[model samples]
Target: MDVISAVGAAIRTAFDMFWDVLWPLVLGFGLSGIVQALVSHKTMAKLLGDDSPRSLSLATLFGVASSSCSYAAVALARSIFRKGASFVSAMVFEIASTNLVIELGVILIVLLGWQFAASEFLGGIVMVILLALIFRVTLTPRLVSLAREHAERDAVGRMEGHATMDMSVQGGSFLSRLLSGRGFTSISHLFVMDWASVWVDVAGGFLIAGALAAWVPESFWQHLFLSGNPTLAKIEGPLVGPLVAIISFVCSVGNVPLAAVLWRGGISFGGVVSFIFADLIVLPVLDIYRRYYGGRVMLYIFATFYVTMAAAGYIVEIVFGALGIIPSNRAVGIITHGPSWNYTSILNIVALVVAAILLVRFLRTGGPAMLRMMSKPETSGEHDHQAIAMDRSIP
Candidate 1:
């Protein structure tokens, strides 16, 4: 009974954290959907043709306007690669798509704090610049040829349909089109599809965070992070953070809540930053890279990406510290007891109603069929063709 009781408590804590951030997530994703729906993927491909500053900036803009689904980002990055975007350029876009998006910023603010959110943005920029520079220096012509060949041969990854869908409303000004029924339809599809891509990560994140928060002793984290010694902790935090993230297997916005847990438990500010950045390189994602871009290219990406993330975290920590902006108090802001009937409940009710309506629309509009086809391996060429046809037919 005690064990069951403890388990129940952990889940309850997890749900409370989810409840707190539920409304912000809905709002963020809703806005992300609208932005994604408005932009054409073809335009993005054109602007991302090279790894020059202009191209990298354009890539960042496109990434901010994209869905916050990491899988979708990977799929879209492959699409970028296939469209003749430089290899370094494609990676920069992938990094921005997952890390620099508006929804991620909003969720980070809500779960952690504004300072943390700011660090994420700053660190994200650092990561992108470093990724581009390092890849250019180290990437070989053979690796590029191999990756391009692999992309040409097999273009699909997780959330292929989600990345491929171009539901942007045509004609009229942006506002006018956004108010149209077709606009609403596009937003609904984007919302549901984006949610579908990352819901598992979100759920798993909350559960893992809750269990860790309830069961792990404070001393353990402090010891692991070397919190007793500030110098060592700062140095080691960025180094170890990614390892933890890789093993956690919870990436994307879902891991932010867990990051909050880590921060409160004595992780360095840099540690939190690197851990969040490491989501893209989680074990699952590394394997995805391997399959999508071939073994040698995947290894190259792994080394460069890991080094960049760690370096960015370390840099952010130093800058923020020198500026005296690092929050002195790191508190885990989860609800102690279960959530009460308050603003959260009210917002959740509204958000769920919206989600339900969108889900209904998704089902009625052939989303399930597309999802099934996209969920299959790259070998499913026939299904891919069918899914593409079906997507084209959608209004």
Candidate 2:
């Protein structure tokens, strides 16, 4: 291909990937916003106050209803930890928030397939359990104390207010509030905040997938993944999956598209799962974790997360093999011709309209000001943990 054609191909590939998953993103985040509006953060903190099975389970459930942005999850996890939630429970919440989120799963289904999405849910639970175990064994009181001190220092996570705000509509029944004006405002804030939190990751995933698909020779990925030997591929894929994510500059729901590209490139099924599970461990996120919880806690979080993610991947490989569902076809190709007239295109058009409506609602609700504060640490995080109004439902 000529230089112009090559560039055009890359751009088209990226757009195609974006168009394919655009509707799913809208649907997932919109629903997540609704969930958040119904749930209260104070309730979350109260229920997750201890590290018992009950607390951990509630934390996971709360996280599934909360924001799916990895940064926001980290920020929120810190918020609860500072509020007396156990360190292990908070860590479990962080994992569930990012991995078991609706948008992440929807995007996975759209891009890769149902099987990959299934693996995500299954592996996510396994990863969380392993993470909890690791933290219980290695996380000591002194380390927790140091981490608490660092959180009190308020080093300013990127989406502090986005994570900290409790905009759930007050008064009225569930349906009434969901249909109220304040409810719309809450949803808009959540929807916009969710987008702002992960736009970079999503766009980065698209661009990286495009570049990788257009430039990297299949032989390189195949040889690197040990695709010629099935057994070696299974072992190496899980091991290298997180390394790919660490360097990919993409995480959260954003990683799904690139995961698609990697799946097509010759990675094993378990390798794909491991890659998606590593979003929070990416370099930028690791820095964010360091800021939120201090270096010692960050190191433990990294070590535990990486080991659990890899183990989950291997377990998925064995389980899927037993179930006779491991896919042999890895020949899916990226779209380079722009969006064709199809159901996905129609859905994209409809989704764009929904997104536009939400954006308008957000701006009118002082979302721009909220965003300004959220983006800058000086403004939004001046006192990140300076206790919000103590209001919660003790479930």
Best model number under TM-score: 2
Candidate 1 per-residue C-alpha lDDT over 1-395 given as tens digits, one digit per residue, 9 for 90 to 100: 38998899789889889998898889888999889768877677778788889999888888888888888788778877887888888888888898998888888887788988899999999998888888778888889999998888774567776666666766799998787666666777778777888999999999999998888888999889899999999999899888899999997898888898899888999999999988889988888898789888888888898999999999999999999999887776564445788887898899888888877766766666666655554344323322333343345
What is residue 30's positional error in candidate 1, in angstroms?
Answer: 0.3
Model 2 residue runs over 4 Å out of place are 333-338, 376-395
lDDT of each: 0.82, 0.83
Q: Per-residue lDDT of 1-395 in model 2, one digit per residue for the tens?
A: 88898887777788888888899999999999999888878777778888888998888898899888888888888888888888888889988998888998888777777888899999989987888787778888999888889887778767777777776766779999888777787788789888998898889889888878887788898888998998999989999999999998787788887887788889999999999999889998899889877898888888889999999999999999999998776755434345678998899899999999989877766676666655554334433211221111111
**What are the per-model numbers of colliding residue pairs?**
0, 0
Q: Could you tell me the lDDT of residue 365 within candidate 2? A: 62
Question: Candidate 1: where are CA atoms >4 Å away?
Answer: 335-338, 363-366, 376-395
TM-score of each: 0.92, 0.93
Among all windows of 10 consecutive residues in model 2, the one with the lowest summed lDDT is: 386-395
